[model samples]
Target: MHPINLNEPATTRPTLAESLSFTCQLGECRSELLPLLSEVSKVVSGEGSLSKTLKLVLELMQKHLQVTRAMISLYDASCDQIFIHESFGLTKDEIEKGVYYPGEGITGKVVETRQPIIVPVIADEPLFLNRTGSWDKTVDCRLSFICVPIMRGMKVMGTIGVERLYNNRQLLYLDLEVLAIIATTIAQAVELHLLERAHKQVLQAQSARLDKELKEKFKPANIIGNSKAMQSVYRMIDKVSHARTTVLILGESGVGKERVASAIHYNSSCGGGPFVKFNCASLPESVIESELFGHEKGAFTGAAARRAGRFEEADGGTIFLDEVGELSLSAQAKLLRVIQERCFERLGSNESIKVNVRILAATHCDLTAMVAKGTFREDLFYRLNVFPITIPPLRERGNDILILAEHFNAWFAKEQQADVPAISTPALNLMLNYDWPGNVRELENMMERAVLLAEEGVIHSYHLPAALQPAVLGELGEQSGLEARLSMMEYELIVEALARFQGNMSRAAAQLGLTRRMLGLRMAKYQLNYKDYRCGD
Candidate 1:
């Protein structure tokens, strides 16, 4: 009989049950096939892994149907090819060779047509390409091939194929009938495997994207300064960011201590964990302990329920205590215990709770002075001072004033939905001469106020705060003469040049279009020190 091909139009193709009539006439009763189908169903639907369950199904087919070899090939949509995923009675090397594009061989044809195919005699069928080499036709020429599409509803997922000794056309039809039912059972397991793999890939992609965003946000470059002092701070931040060492951030108030703490936290090994921030100076002495270490219910007059402290909230992460020197001696002692033992007792709670937390503390006050004054604990100061980073006051940062002003101008402009205004010459000179005792935070606030007032798209001297205006300087009895202003501007230009060149006087003078002698005379006039602008300053 010609090789059976059910690769016809859906309406014309006979159903698999109707095709089994020939097997019934050949004495392979349909009732007898129920046991084999039941066994395959149990194996495929079992709780084992996909690969193991599919492997067992193939072995069952070989044992019950007298099949010589069998394989379950899965469709890889990415490559548009089918590869053997599980097999029985085939060597590993043979399975490696069993890859086929759609419609390339018997297995590929079954996948493409979404139908069954029966090759009565392998030696006579040119389409039986034996790509796997397991079926050597020269040695065994009496083998028959049966392949059926493994489908999920109307969609074809892959194919399953079997090889058996050629008995007659009736028995070949019987083998086809048995294998088709097994392919149906295998489809559910394959679909679930594909879905699980897709879900894992999505999660992995999201994690990678978030990690990249965090790295970009915390890079030292985002701090927005190129002056020698700020560069030194950047180097320090980079060095301590990957360790668990306690860091003492020493800077004047409003110097962006919290910003620096965040940079270290997001770049450290605990980057993905929570970052809890508490200002030690913001709370009063009466409730500071409860705020730090949670109080039990009814522990105090206002304590209504149990609460988690900052340390407990920061478990497996970091806690940033701004103005740590402001904490009372009692709180300081508790903090010291947490730092040394990684454990502490909550307020009014006798039981000590443990945690894993990295501590980062900041203060504008001198801890050594506080310790000397008998206010701050000396041991806590030593514990918190493992690594110290000092951010320079804004006045010493030279042209970083201009850089930060421009950044804040553009940023606030976008935030307030206004045009980014230009900084007029007088405004630039005024900003250069201001002491900026409030540091970067003062500069940010001034720029925001200036952006609001510079409605004409240009920031003039009058748009700045009274602290940076000439009229205000005159009212405050500060120098405001044109000669004094010119001298200040000249001194600022010299400082910017020196800072940019790392205090190389020759380069700094060349950049200013002046001789080294003239540059030194001007620096001497303003009492500006070049050594202070050096790299390690």
Candidate 2:
């Protein structure tokens, strides 16, 4: 079986796409696959910045493939060693301790053997690499792993690597195949990464480097956070970026859910893929369907040309529907059918247009409550919620408040080309104290305003909106005690790391630099259960 056969006879083996939704559902997995392969050619020619490309690639792996992490370790042909060239979600300690290496580990063994190996449980795998004599100090408790040789023709480039979850359940054969696909894609991309670097060097040496000017297309940029909450978002993105799953992003207004959606599509296995976006709330009933699914020429009064809809235009890539909660019942039903079947008909045309689109949706409204109220269809909710991710409101994410404020300050300063200025102590305190009802979005707007208004070298409290800057020093007294708030903040940050790392206490601890036991005790104290919150849709 091709592993993509949608319908399988009961006696015959079930197809790989049978369990997976996108390949079979879209009826054009080949179309999707070839495009991504072709995209590598474009990626090679695009740039020579290894870090930017690798960072973007790793981020995409998180979004598209649903894999916890991805790596492109290469065989240093000259040095006869494996270089842990690029990775995401791996800690500094792990990478240094031969996480993926020729330094006495499984990857090294795989390179030595020139064959792929599957360890359903890392614990049970033979002792090939023992950088650490035993598992006593290794942060990697992730036992389910697969290492495939990155071969260029018959020559092995390096080892393409993947792990299921941290300390996860045993890896099934099916999971092995999944890892193989990831390895195949990554091996190809990494090879291109190397070729790109070489070509970039050639261009730079010749002074023939092309000027890369990116137009400000108003696609969301700089949705920054490395805190536990954002890490959780990064993980969820890792899980579903490449797959054709229906993703539902839930968050309050200004939580940057749309930005997150864009990240998912751009970082998924389809990072090079086209991204088509529609604000469902902005359009009326008659236009919404036509705009999203497309309309034929003369289908509507002003429909002069046969235009491809967002779904078709985003073929082999992603289509993001923002504010999907606002969709009318009839529209919701049609959306549900399209999501379920991956086929739609243009207005005034009975012929079905099949598109290879990965669907990502975001809404500030609570779909569960809406479903309960009969405003949203339960079926649509179920389809979209196959993978559901929630972005925490600003108030809930602890000191990320300050971190994001700093990020926005820098970004807005550059955007508006205001000479960069530091925030005054009073201004910083005001921002940290305010409960951002609009989350990151609100903070960004406030920073933009402050940067514009500040005539002096520093942003002061007086420049902030009246709601944020109160004259009375006593206003701070009305909120929770600072000590108590900091304690809760510390507690939440710990829990977020645990969840973000998929309960890998060691990696989570590395991110926080706390002992695994220390992190656990805090979890026990706070009574936090964050297992489901870590990995994304």
Candidate 3:
């Protein structure tokens, strides 16, 4: 391929499409057409995107084909719809109304027949719809119109068109051949765009569907948390839901570590299969192997009947080994073999029984330290750590305590028909101050007790659990760490202080025991203004 000067008019250069046409007449175009194609070859060989390639095709056609107006409509292979993607002469309104179905118009006919259409007069062509409204009631009464089908093998994807200003016998066969070559260029560009759009749509649909299905199927009744940290864990569940990998759920005790493990398995590819749960800490060192790997008839002293092990039962699914750090030395070695080879033998059966399942292990104990102490297999740790999702505890995630408390409180109120009081300022203060060691699971328990004790809609200071409540019910406690709680509070104290002072700068500063400048910095950090709280401050 050689270069052609793009600045020259279209009639000067012979198009490659014109070379392939029977009607094209060649006089003096070979020299001009060859260099243009060479430049085209260089550009088309660079970035292989739909937009770039379409622009290239239009440039090629404009250089060689002495015709009026051109357009490329692409076929969305998946949707079976034709849409005009790019055009040079069509008005914006014309383009908006440019969608074509098979056999509907001249373009449609070419697409339907997988052949070219040569209408010397567009107005004379029977299939031409002339969309009068699209072009302000003015029909394209061109004397020479040519439409050719663009094909990917036998399937017609789109059509490219070229029309001469007037019907003339003087137009050479080489010109039509050049237009045909340009039409082929349009076809290649359409294919690339269609494929790219299809890939993006497929990925988007998969991601959305997976997220929706996970929330519906895997939500356990006992698990509770709407905090950002817990939502982060939920998003991880959505991401790894369909993946085939080892998942390690890490959290402190009473943090519903088992609940997180269940969500993972139920959302995974092995969701339809059995969920085999085993407490590694509860099983004795000698029997842990038989319990996990299963025993055949007479495999052990108490092997009264042929029993399938946890692994065998959980085949084609997930095996949740809770407290996995407590596995003894021998058990860790056997487990490592299962992780590496995915093959394990029953206690009595010498025949190797291969299990097809995802491994989900949970631990309240620190496995990192256990790996350092040589109590746990480092290889097993790495294998299961493919996706490690941690459930953050209550102490770090503030406000989640209130959200979960309100949820569980509502549940308990409905269950027992108790008239639970609204949370008092003092009780809320106590709640905000106390460090909940038990996390969301603990907050749920406290709410249950509060709902039971409260006599009214308010869960007052009296309704709070002993651990969370100050001894003096009526008064806010001095040693209750309310000062420290206010210091750590993000926005509530600043808002309340500003409200009490009626947003007067000096008064609000005096109320908060801060300089006006210090108060401003706090206001900036929280994005709060006293004017925001006031009807008219």
Candidate 4:
């Protein structure tokens, strides 16, 4: 008799007499076998847990088949061995000893050759190692054994074996056929379980990678400032990041208060949680309340669905309220309650919901001044003032402008897929002397524009906006004195000459019809550096 080929249907190979004989016995075992298959099917299709499904398979086999011992040994491809994964009618100690190398015994040989084996009598078959100690060699054990490979397509994943009394030999072939069918089902279930586990692992790895990237992007080191004022802000951030204190970031309109809030959230103890932000000034006064504390369905006109508020959404995380000073007095009252009690009701509902969200508020307006004018609540100001961090305006952060310029240069270069150009000394000097009223936001926009305008692989002063030109040029018309005006024009001529000649003093002086020594004296008087024009070289 040849081993059954699992790749084909189980019914294809048997002869008419063999088929009739198995069919008669199959009918006899139908009462018990039908329920066993039903239960195994439920297990395999439901949760698809491999261990639980294997355990159920073994338990049903022992109960319905009246086997002395039953075991399922799964193949470990890494070690090329079959280890007992689930077993019925065996002690824990005996199960621990049930391991076999390829072709070691009946069970191992079945797995190694992807075939089935049946021993009519265990005492007569030399290949039956009895590693599980189901039968004693000293006694006359009348046990018959059958083992079959659990095949997935052409590959054998494991083997299922059962031992029964010798008197049950009349239906041995029938039992083998049933076990083979069950083994095929087990193989498919195992394959599906493995595939699902691998897919979950891939998703988890991708999630972890995205989380790591977000954390790094918002880390304190990436905030882009080395000024003393920014150093103080960094220290404040470090001190309050792990705490649940309410942070109030004070700065000018374009000073990156939101970025500071994000840095605090992503570096805090609740970094893994969500960070929800709302611009209180951007929304209308009529709907700002509903936006912060979401309203119920049909609560107001066009309110079609129940929506979670930022506070509710940011539970166990952080919420940044930008332009907090713009909130109405009624909204301020509701916000004050959340800050003090950590609970608030929805806009149209009286049901109070509790949340554990960290508050990080930012505003360009002075809340204290607004409170004096009765536009803001005084009590709310004190509550939000627990930990105040003031970000310096760009004019006060000396030399940080150059650092930020380079950062923006590289960022926009990559964004536009262009090469980052070197900043000329004249351009750097103009940036340093300019009093940036729009702060970092304006500087970032200006750098992006400069990169777009740059054509010679270097950022010259001409690439900068006309607004960045010296205040002296704007002051010329107001200064009515002829001497002052003439001196200004002379200074301009010398600078323009030097710039036109790429800082070559001889060429500049010859072009301007002045000796090199006289041009050097004028350059000193105007505080102009000749080397700043060398980009033309």
Candidate 5:
């Protein structure tokens, strides 16, 4: 087939009949072509989506050319195939199944060659494979197939094709010309759409990279402690993060259970996947199942639309079920199935959905105790207890209290945009002595409050909560009688003096209004390490 140059003038003057036919075709083309171009130009310049624009183009093709079916097949570079992306007069099933490899059929050949193909009759064209299943051979003898390549420079990005009823052969040529022009106009829109999509992908990749870096920087290692208990927790996190095993984080409330769960997720192989968290205790029994497993549209009174639950959303990622012990027995039964089979059905639907999510459950309550009491399922407990990590309470973490205090102090100071203050020795002692009933959460809150209250670049004992004062002093008082309390007071005074005097025993004794021998006896009685005081000085 020779290329008909749209720009080339006719070689000779037209005959009377040829001129009349050309005028009739021109009138038909102007009526349909002007509106098509106007609508397409608006779509290309405006914020209309690529699908809507393509569908409009196909609809115009059918209306103008008496087309039976029109479709656009977009090139997928990843799969090295062309698949129908948008179409007119094709069912959803047909559109979904329409796929053609490069050079597979007439459409594929057009894409491969970067040229157009015109089939005068479908029955005579061996290359027409009718892959879309929309073509009926019994009564379609008059169907003329025309496909044009949608190009971006020399590259064939996709193909636009239409099936129109055969009429005059001369009119068929004009139709081919119109289709080529329309395809060229649609190509620009497709190019812009692809570029916009590529830009979004690049931005998303950058965002994901930044998010991953932040997660890595603030992982469990940044939990502000090097205590033996914390070190053990870190070791457990390292071991559990690499596996897809179920993790049961056991700890009292406010012990940083959620922090542990986050650490496990961000350090794992599936870190690139999402980290979905749901609090079982926060949702009521009636809604807990729907929240975990999702619900179909109209499944319940308030379910307005189909929803994907935490498990479904966490597919190929990690889902942290905080306060797992609060799940109802029915919910537990469904959760056990998900843990055992990696599949579950949404509420009010029988279709099972499979997920490859890691489970990280946490609770302050003892599952073992709950199981014995019949409130929790024993089978589910055993399933979730594959690996257990118990975070130590703040009261039992020893010197981690001071470490955490200093960390929180600096953090709060920065947050408040104020100068960070030093913790006075008296303040430090008071904090170390108090039993943190609310655990790490309470300690953090106290530190934040102290930072806000501190004004003199030093967090004095008075800056802390007033309740902590009585608690620390009462604990010491209860542990000793009146004589012992007097001895402790004397010891504290001597220690302060020694620190003030740079650990010089004579100067310390002078400051304390005592002889060197009496001061030494008091220090020995209290087991005061003089070297510790000297180092501070």
Candidate 6:
């Protein structure tokens, strides 16, 4: 296909149909139109995507028709302009320059009026703007431009246009008819493409919302405690979770020290990375070094293959050392080195392996005493204790015992596929009286036993273990007379229920299995004002 030389002097040229008639017969225009439309139909209805189908449609127009260039422009509501969506025989720079406002040029006029336009000679028509630089504007050019609005019903979507060399006005009108037919086919394909793009945007929005919900479920605030002591712990967790600080969690055994460490790790910036846990007291001193610092093959008597330690496994994440004070002095020195340099050499290998990790250590022992006695290194102790958080024992966490008991009861009942039973007043009194030496761990185990042993839908005092029976209650309870003990127990239960409900009388009565009148009478007998337990407003 030769390009029309726009720089040539104005001269007489044969019409397009006259040129074709010299090569072929006279009545062959319908035969040419039929095959071109059929090829365009096959390209439009193909299983290819919108972008691919549009590209082939433009290319087919240039190939089967005697046109120098073909293009499909689409209306962009975002910018309120018509821009060339796809084109053939035009460079990328030229295509970028093909933009027009509504009714600005021949293509824009077709879009605005929703009609086809034919320019018998481009140089003679001032509306045929050569904005794409496909031809020289300073010379007489015998090029014809035909543009048809791509429409759906009465609305115009955009325009499909072509540039050709034609001298006869009758042949230019015929070219306009061919462009109109192709524009109709393109309209259907463009409609489907818009629908698919809208559906994809909806799916992307839904996926983002679900991702946010899942992240909220694992946040530190989901630990489930409303006590003032626990609130302080939550504040500490929130502060440390945003940094790379080494944290030392101090708490008694069974006080959920590991749980606090887990909360910090999951809420941190590196929450997506691995979280590796190791128990320093679980292994013997002889193999503790090999376990903390990965050992190479044949490093020890029983060592068979190379292995990665918890520190190496926790690269770009966090490592939790439980009972950290139990680490041997030799292992402590190696841990101190890793904390200082962020690198460590495996046992039996001199090659140092670098790691990027945050350390979180927990211990129930007195690290200061151990450091003074030379059992634990002072340098290592200081490194691990940069940010210390102590979780209070369950006995010290006032009303949280009842909250935790209810949570564990519901959890275990779900696990066993049994109905959740209500803890009776007698059983509640026994729990509040006893001192939980084993902390939350002891309460959790007791609740599991109580839930399993409970008959019907109520957990009575007899359903609890022997340690929580009347004989044990007598030793921990008021030790006054029987009536006095009952009255004091009644007062304590009312106060706890009101505090838990934040002075909501209705909910407090529901939890205590009493009516509004009965709860009010009890509150009066104890001289308790519900307003005293009200928080905020």
What number of clashing residue pairs does each candidate have, in the order they appear?
Answer: 0, 14, 41, 0, 0, 0
Give candidate 3 regions above 4 Å deviation: 1-224, 419-421, 470-537
Ranking by lDDT: 1, 4, 5, 6, 3, 2
Candidate 4 has which clashing residue pairs, if any?
A: none
Q: What tens-digit string does per-residue lDDT give for candidate 1 at 171-231?
A: 6666776787788788766754554444335434654564465454334645766666876
Tens-digit lDDT track of model 3 for 130-187: 5423322245565566677776545577877765554443353344555566555555
RMSD of each: 25.8, 27.5, 25.5, 27.8, 30.1, 25.0
Local lDDT at 345 for model 1: 84
Please give the lDDT score for candidate 4: 0.78
Q: What is the model-wide C-alpha lDDT for candidate 1?
A: 0.79
The local distance difference test score of model 5 is 0.77
Better candidate number, 2 or 6, judged by lDDT = 6
Q: For residues 312-424, could you state the per-residue lDDT of candidate 5 as single tens digits?
A: 99998999999999998999999999999999999999999999999999999988989999999999999999999999998888777876787899999999998776665
Reference-based lDDT, residue 306, model 1: 95
Candidate 3 has an lDDT of: 0.67
Better of 2 and 5 by lDDT: 5
lDDT of 2 by residue, 426-452 (tens): 455467668998778788888888888
Kindly provide the TM-score of model 6 when superposed on the true structure, using C-alpha atoms.
Answer: 0.49
Stretches off by above 4 angstroms in model 6 are: 1-222, 469-537
Q: Return the clash pairs for model 6, or none.
A: none
Residue ranges of candidate 1 with Cα displaced over 4 Å: 1-221, 471-537
* Model 6: per-residue Cα lDDT over 147-210, one tens digit each: 8888765667788888877655445555666777888887866743443333335434644564
Sequence-dependent TM-score of model 2: 0.47
